[model samples]
Structure formats: structure tokens, C-alpha cells
Target: MMIQMELSMLNRNGTLVSEEETEEVTGIHCENLVIAFAVSNSPDFRSIRIIKTIKMCSHCHTFAKLVSEKYKRQILIKDPNCLHKFKGGKCSCEDYW
Candidate 1:
């Protein structure tokens, strides 16, 4: 559920740039959408599960681990490539992503 912040990049002077340029400069295309959902939903549940059709990007993957550790809860994220279990600042993939 990660959402891209910008569909296109803007320069410091506000000129638009290519998506490739944006990705190269930021190394990020998406932000963690699950964290917000998890925090709001956690009070009613002990664990959370997320399903994604695309591969989980590296940043969101890391954020999931942090959220899991901070909340002392488990997060299960299933992306097309793998299933990740995040807990206590660790991931089943061991940060290999």
C-alpha cells in the first residue's frame, strides 16, 4: 500500500525532472502505508497482516521492521517475491532487501 509521493520530480528551482532522475536522487519511490494502518488497527488486534501485489521496496521494508519493534507486535507482509515477518527490529529476510 505504499504510495509514491510524487509522480514526477521537481528541481530545487521547481523545474520538473524525469522519474528516473527522481529515483536516482532520492533512492525512494514509495513510503510505508502499513505503519499508519497498523497503529490505528493494532489496538484491536495482536498482529497485522499486509498483502501487496508488487515487491516491497527497501525503505518500506525497513520501516516495517522498526514499527514492529517499537510496538512489540508482529507484522506479516506478503509481496509477490517473498513473505516477510517483522519483529523486534528484525525481519525474516534479515535485511537482505
Candidate 2:
């Protein structure tokens, strides 16, 4: 599993936030992971599954959605918070997680 420190997240209110009151969350950066996966794996393998220990950052989540649409592939990312399926320029989380 990939990991990185996250400076922000969305609270229950659906607002973008950084947990300054406590500390920044740490998580995987899916974009770089996906790029590396693509580089190491065959192009014929269109779908991918990633198991992460923490939540995904917003930028990487958006990138996953865009990349999945552009490449016409399915990306399934399972993190501590939830499962995210990225395809057709969208994520199953709908940008909530």
C-alpha cells in the first residue's frame, strides 16, 4: 500500500478542511501510484485494485476520476475510510470521501 501525509480532508459537513485542530492525516496519493502501476503493468491490463491504509487526498481522487475516464479503465481503491471506484470522470464517493 502507498502512503503520504495529507494536510486536509472533508468533514461531515462536506466542506474542504485541514485538521489543524489535531494533525494532518496521512494517506496514499493515487495519481502517482496509478502512474507507476501503468508503467510497470501491461497496457492490456485495464483495471487495477489498490489497497491503502489511509484515506486518499482530493487531488489524487480527482486525478483518478479523470484518468479512469481518459483511459477507459476501472480503478478500485480501498482505504480505511471507504472504497472508491473511479470511472467515466467520476468517483463512487462523489467527492465526499
Candidate 3:
């Protein structure tokens, strides 16, 4: 859910955006956004599902951090390379050395 939202938000409009743009994207308030495709408003589902099949992107990392802070929620993003958990003002990279 979080990861997918990150990916959709990243891969939206056929262009890859920058970190700054990601944060900026979050601030985007659109009437159309409310009617977006991600119809499920389940926060638990959001945390459980891995939105993108691929691993998290570098830019998405920063965006995830900002989201965790802004909403005061925990976001766990898993990639081919690592499993990352963001919460409590810290990131736990799950013993990935």
C-alpha cells in the first residue's frame, strides 16, 4: 500500500520524479485525487501490501521518511536488496550488511 502509493506517485504521468518532487507531490491537493484508483482506505492493508513488485527506489526512501514523520506512522518497505522499517524517528535496516 505505502510502497505502491510511493511507486504510483513516483511513476505517475509517465515521468520519474525527484525527491523534492515527491515531497511536493504529497502536498498536492486535487479533487481528482479523492477519486483515485486505490479505493481501499484500509490502513492495515496499506502497511501489509508491497505496492510495487520491485524494490523501493532511492528517491522513495526520502519520501517514505517524510511520510512517516508527517503522519506519525510506521512504513515498512521491502526491496530486492533490503528490508527497511521506518518509525520513531529512525530506520531499521534489518541486519542487512
Candidate 4:
């Protein structure tokens, strides 16, 4: 399910790359992929909450902000380190994490 979601997201965002070019899209994390999939498929949802086991990287954080802004949805991501609330292309962390 996760793999499918990632593939779908990569395809939709035109981020899918060949083996040698994988580094170019390293910013596309699992959380970002899942959230993108959920948002795209569930139009009725106005907000999204995600629990991540590890601390989210800066790229994932930025991705979440972008997703929230693009979808006009509030996104709450709780990782081991902190709670990140994203809305209108901004994150509660202020890019600290």
C-alpha cells in the first residue's frame, strides 16, 4: 500500500526518476507521499493528521507545508520530536525542525 502510494505520488508530481537520478527526488518522503495520496483521493477531507515514528526531515516538513497550502487543508504531523501544524504554506515550527 505504501509503495503504491509513493509511486502514484511520484507519477502525479512528476518526481519519479531513474535509479541514477533518485537523489534528485529525495525530498519526497513517505509521509509526504501518504499525505498526497490521501488528499488527492479523499476530496471531502479538509484536514489531515499523521503520526510518524521518526523526526521529520526538513524536506518532508516543507513538503507538508506545500501540500497544506495547495490543498487548502490543515495538516498536523506528530513526529517523535515535535508536533508540526502546517497551513497556508507555513509550519508551526517555523522551519526550526
How accurate locally, in lDDT, is each candidate? Answer: 0.70, 0.66, 0.48, 0.72
Backbone clashes in model 3, listed as residue pairs: 4-51
What is the Å distance of residue 65 in model 3 from its true position? 0.7
- lDDT order, best first, reads 4, 1, 2, 3
If scored against the real structure, what TM-score would every candidate get?
0.62, 0.61, 0.45, 0.67
Between candidates 1 and 3, the one scoring higher on lDDT is 1
* lDDT tens digits, residue span 8-56, model 3: 3445467877534644567542211321322235453244323334455
lDDT of 2: 0.66
Q: Residue-wise lDDT of candidate 4 within 1-97, one digit each (tens)?
A: 2223323234456775542233345544667767877787766455777777667877778888888888888888899889999998999988997
Model 3, CA-based lDDT: 0.48
Residue lDDT tens for model 2, 1-97? 3333344567778888644322344454444455456635646345666666556777768777887887777888887899999878889998897
Candidate 2 displacement at residue 28 in angstroms: 8.9
Could you tell me the TM-score of candidate 2? 0.61
- Which ranges of candidate 2 are over 4 A from the true structure? 1-31
Candidate 1: C-alpha lDDT: 0.70
How far residue 75's Cα lies from its native spot in candidate 4, in Å, is 0.8
Rank order (by TM-score, best first): 4, 1, 2, 3
Clashing pairs in 4: none
